[model samples]
Target: MIIAVGSQSKIKVTAVKNALCQLGVKADIEAVKAHSAIAEQPFNQETRQGAINRALHTAQLVPRAAFTLAIESGLYWRMDAWLDIALVVARFPDGTCVEVESEAIVFPSSAVEEVQRRGVHTWTAGQVLQEWGQVQSHNDPHLSLVGKSRADFIQDAVVKLFQTLQARHLLSV
Candidate 1:
């Protein structure tokens, strides 16, 4: 199976490979830059549209592939703070589509505001957290607060998301 990954970011490439490995999927995967944009604010529609845009673009570029994978993520204030939510959209050759979404624990608002204030155009959840000086806060009570690095958190979430997708039979190798 040939799978076209919609982005060329290191984190996304690693996440996709790790997800495929964990799911026992055997396929040839390649990364192609489908869109040129960064996250500014969080919204459900924007996230979905980003993924859809990438998926459609990649599909045009890699027409022979079994399916195209697109991932769009953003941080939103849920409950009281920003939470990382990534939604994956898959487009098959026959025009069918499937979507999967994964979310992390809410992030503190101070962190989000600080990052936004810095005018940083390219920042991930991990970078945003680091800017807030919470990298070493071992006592902060939150979900998955066992000193888990942001990278690890995203990896776990992607793996779980792959599981969720497979259970739904969205894609198969």
Candidate 2:
């Protein structure tokens, strides 16, 4: 099987590999550049759409692949605080798709202020978190807050999505 991933980021690619391993499916995985079709700092539903768009875009790049996976991280406002969420979209060869999301972690008010009040990207906030020694990677500052490794968070979502696909009989190992 061939699995195409939307982003070239190591964390995303590793998550895909880990998820596949968890499912006991062996395949060649490739990472391709794909557009999210949303703002650099997407929120809520926009984040979900970005993941879907990326998966669709990746599917276009590798149409013969058995599955295309897109993973996107974004911030959302909830209960007067900003929280981080990772959205995953998996597109099958038959034009069917499954979506899943990670548990959210609250972002520091300062980091949220940088994005909301200063028009800075969430990645920039992640950089700030890195400077403060609160996070190790700019791509997943929630790693610090949630005490979960970046790959683990992403893999969890992908695993759930694949499980859903299996339950629906849309995927088989």
Candidate 3:
């Protein structure tokens, strides 16, 4: 099977690989450059839309692939605090789509402020966290704040979506 992933991020790619492994499937996976079409720090709806957009865009890029996967991370405000959310989307060649999401984690106020006030990207905020020794990687801060690795979070979402497709008999193998 040929699978196309929307982002070049190692975390996202590894998550897909891990999820597929859990399902006992193997495939040739490729990463394609795809845009989220939303702000660097997107809100609830924007985050979901971004994930969908990336999946659709990657599907268009590799139309022959059995599946296209997209993962998007964003921030949302709730109860006077910012939180982190992740959305995963999968698109099949037959025009079927599935989506799953990660639980929200309360984000660091300082990082959120920097993104909102200085117009910095979430990645930049992550970098700041790295400098403070709060985060060990550039792509994930949830590791420190929520005690959950980014790969695990992404894998959970992908696994949920894949299970849904399997339960519905929408996916073969």
Highest TM-score against the true fold, candidate: 2
Candidate 1, residue 23: the lDDT equals 79
Question: lDDT (CA) for every model shown?
Answer: 0.69, 0.82, 0.81
Sequence-dependent TM-score of model 1: 0.73
- Candidates 1 and 3 compared: the better one by TM-score is 3
User: TM-scores of all models?
Assistant: 0.73, 0.88, 0.86
Give per-residue lDDT, candidate 3, residue 38.
80
Q: Please write out the lDDT profile of model 2 over residues 1-173, one tens digit for every residue.
A: 78899999888888888887899867899899999978777777888889889999999999988889999988788888887878888888787878888877788978767666656443456776777787888766766778777678888888888788788986677
Best by lDDT: 2
Per-residue lDDT tens digits for candidate 3, residues 5-98, read 9999988888888888999767788999988788776766888888889998999899888889889887778788887778888888777778
> Candidate 3: global Cα-lDDT?
0.81
Candidate 1 lDDT by residue in tens digits, 1-173? 89898988776777788888877888888899997254544454767777888888999999998888887776655676667677777788887778776646666667667667765465444465555566553222233344445445555666776676678786564
User: Candidate 2 or 3, higher lDDT?
Assistant: 2
CA deviation > 4 Å runs, candidate 2 = 121-123
RMSD of 2: 2.1
Worst 10-residue lDDT window for candidate 2 reads 115-124
List candidate 1 stretches off by more than 4 Å.
Answer: 36-44, 115-129, 136-146, 168-170
